[model samples]
Target: MNCQTLLIDDAPAVRLQGAAGDTVTVLLRGAQVISWVDASGVERLYCSPASPLKGPQAVRGGVPVIFPQFAARGSLMRHGWARMRGWTLQPWDTSAPEPSVSLQLHNAVGDDPQWPHACVCTLTVSLLPNGLRMALTVENTGPASFSFHAALHTYLAVGDVAQTTLAGVLPEGAVLSLREPIDQIFEAVTGPLQLHSPLGLLRLEHAGFGDVVVWNPGPDAGLADLPPLGHTAFACVEAAAVMQPVALAPGAHWQGSQTLLSGL
Candidate 1:
């Protein structure tokens, strides 16, 4: 079957199976992608073994969609409420011949008291033979203009932390190598980027998104959601609009996308 529904931690989840044996699993709890693998059964994304299964909190790994805010940079709670709430699974479009699914989040109006803006968000995930595509659209439904930041926090598994390299050079004219734990937001960049790691090479293409956040809580840092030495297993290269948020006028929507290709 190309599409299948199942339960994860008593939460609704969908599995989108692509033609070339690629498979992607997403949870309705946060409309977060928890697992992704290529046709050869080689896992592409990282889902922390210590990530909480059920949550009013963010999962430690995978593609966690951050919306309306990027961390504590706004009035909203850390990373906003998108990853902490469950999303509605939408019906598949018959016209699209590919294996795909859409998720919606619109209850932020009354539920969020900190910010008083009505909005609707739609996230579409499409599985491909060699990679995966994700699209996000956020519309302002309120009368006033609203501004917000967003990100696709992706945790990629690697063979070793010290050995991995972010293929693109920094805006300052130098490439970045993870020598210690890294946690920094990069300047806006254009075009595609490559990630060279021990496990494999990954190509990340950004569209309508400019900022990137490269993070890994080095060995010195400790997080409750991760296991001992878990930081060594994965590195996050996220697509985000953290440096500058998008401002939307009433009835207007902001859309962006990111593509991940495995073993390139």
Candidate 2:
């Protein structure tokens, strides 16, 4: 069957009326979300960009485009360039049983100065029977040093912050926030990373990632224009990067995936 867009609104105030081709239904009540549904197939975060307690917008969300250097790229903004520009979209492949869509973004020649490199990035938002999956694939179409980040800065809906205890491969001080930096790291994590939110139990699991960043903008951190992020109803539990940057030689490819599951 040819691909078509469908809008279905179920009970309990679930807004599933968004166009399937335009945006993916990642969030139900704005809070239970998989925001940053860009046409480029990248999903940013709905909560704070950078770690709030760490620094607002430091590296918050919007499919941060990383380049030659991560923290010291000195190119466009933090991370590198990617998310800063508009992306193009087209149908690719969704082999999974559940409905899914794919989008791609490439640097144009006229506007290549920003990145000064030739590369193609594709983000796929696959709606699986169980949950949603976002996959990022970066390919070097030019002859240049290339390495960027494709992360999902997740703001997990929670009840309380202080009472939350996280499990998983996180070290004692792997890092909860940038300001309150810690030097702990866990080798292998199997159970759910627990968070004691006033709301209820919050659990986070890292599937294909090496680092995890947990954040709570707390009362001390100022506010922004993010209405989806209820004052303190969310917690930023992310799959961190900062490892070996993908040094693509030409015609090279790099890919990564991050998944989020939610429940009270």
In candidate 2, what are the lDDT values of residues 1-264, reduced to their tens digit?
Answer: 124432323211111212333244322111123343333333424444333312223324323333333444355556455544344445534454545555567764456566577878775555432234566677888866665544445555444344444555445634242223122323334435655444444345545445555555555445554434343455565554555345677888877565544333
Model 2, residue 91: distance off in Å is 1.8
Off by over 4 Å in 2: 1-74, 92-95, 109-114, 171-208, 226-231, 262-264
| TM-score to true structure, per model | 0.95, 0.62
Which candidate leads in lDDT? 1
Give lDDT: candidate 1, residue 61: 89
**Model 1: which ten-residue window has the lowest total lDDT?**
167-176
Candidate 1 similarity to native, TM-score: 0.95
- Relative to the true structure, how large is the alpha-carbon lDDT of every model? 0.84, 0.46
lDDT (Cα, 0-100) at 49 in candidate 2: 39
Candidate 2 least-lDDT 10 residues: 9-18
| Superposition TM-score, candidate 2 onto the true structure | 0.62
